[model samples]
Target: MTSQNKSVPAFGYEIIRDYALSTILGKHADDVLYWVGKDIARKFPCSDIQLIISFFEDAGWGTLSIEKEMKDGYIFQLTSDPDLLNIKNRKFRMEAGFIAEQIQCFKGCLTECYDEKKEKQSVVQFTVKWDTKEKIG
Candidate 1:
C-alpha cells in the first residue's frame, strides 16, 4: 500500500495527545506542551508525578512524557508514536485488540460506534475514546 501524499497523522493522534494531558493533569491544554517545565508539569499535576506515571502505566500505553507538544501545530513525531503508526492499514482484529486494550485501561473513554459494513449479517461493535480535554477534577 502506497500513496501519492505522505506525512499524515494517524486516526487518533491528536486525541491521544489531548487525552494524555487531560488524564494526567485534570485540566485542558490551552496550549500544546513543549518545554521541559511544561512537560514536567504535565507529568506532575499539582506535584503528583508518581500518580501520573502510574496512570499511564495502568493505561497500557506505557509511560508517556510530554516529549514535545507544539503550541501552534502538533509535534507530529511526538503526537504520532511508532506503535500507533505501525497499526495503520492493519487488520480489523488487530485494531480491535488495541482499542479494547485502551478502553479497558480507563485512560480514555468509549463513545458511540457503528459499523459501516454488514456483509456477514453480523453487527460489528466498537467504542471510541474521548478526544478532548475537560474538567474531570
Candidate 2:
C-alpha cells in the first residue's frame, strides 16, 4: 500500500494535537487554531454545502448534518460515536473555523461561526452566520 494510504492511529493523532495546543500553543491556542482552520478551508475550497458535509465525513472529523437554515446562515450538527469523544475543545474550534471560512469564501461574504458542545449527546452544534447584503469578501 502507498504511504499515503496508511492508516494512522486516531489516539496518537489526538494526543499529539492536544499536546501541541496545550503545551506549545498555550492560552492562545484556540484563537491560533481557529485561524489556522480558516486558512485550511481556503486552501481546500468546496463547491457546495453538501460537499462540506462530505468533507467532514471523509476527513473523519464527524458526521455533519444541517440542523437548520436561515436567510443569514446555517446551523450544523457534528456527531460522532462515543469512542471518539475524547478530543479537546480547541480541536473542535478548528472545525468550526473551517466551516465558517469555507461558507464565507463560497458566498463571497463575511461569515462567523460558533460551536456548542453537548457532552451528554456526544455532539457539537455549529452556528454559522453571514451578512446577506455584504457579499464582498
Candidate 3:
C-alpha cells in the first residue's frame, strides 16, 4: 500500500495506542509496550541516530531531537503537533524503551531509558544512560 493509504489518523492512532492498549493491558500496558518497542527496534534496527530520527517520523511518534549529551548518556526531546500534544495522560515509555535498546545496540553496553512528560510544554524528554563498565559481547 502507498504511504498515504497506510497512514492512520491521529485520533485513530491514539485510540488504539493509548486507549485500547491501556484498556486491554491495564496497569501492565506501559511495561508491555516498553518491551514491544524494544522488540520493534530489534526487528528494525537503526545503525545511526539519523535513521532513528527518521523512524520516529515515519512511525508518527513525533519529532525527535537531541537535547543534551553526557559522559554516560544523552537526553532527547520529543515534540508533536497539537493533536498529539494535547492528549491527556499520554505515556512515552515505549519510545523510551525503544531508544534504550537502540543505544544499547549502538554502544554495546547495558542501557536504560527514562521518560519525563512535560504536559504543560507538550513535550517528552528521554534520558538514556548506559553502563560503560558492562559491555556486551
Which residue runs does candidate 3 get wrong by more than 4 Å?
A: 1-5
Question: Residue by residue across 1-89, what tens digits does model 2's lDDT show?
Answer: 88647767988877777675668888887788789889888888897899889889877787999999999999999988756655343
User: How many residue pairs in model 2 have overlapping backbones?
Assistant: 0
Residues 1-137, candidate 3, lDDT per residue (tens digit)? Answer: 78756767778878888788889989898899889889889998999788889999888888999999999999999999857765356778788889988989999999999988887888889999999999977
Highest TM-score scorer: 3
TM-score of each: 0.20, 0.90, 0.93
| Worst 10 contiguous positions by lDDT, candidate 2 | 82-91
Clashing pairs in 2: none
Per-residue lDDT value at 41 in model 2: 88
After superposition, which runs of candidate 1 have C-alpha atoms over 4 Å from their true positions? Answer: 1-10, 14-32, 35-46, 58-61, 64-82, 85-137
Looking at model 3, the pairs that clash are none
Per-model CA lDDT versus the true structure: 0.33, 0.83, 0.87
Q: In terms of lDDT, which candidate is strongest?
A: 3
Instruction: Flag the better candidate by TM-score, 1 or 3.
Output: 3
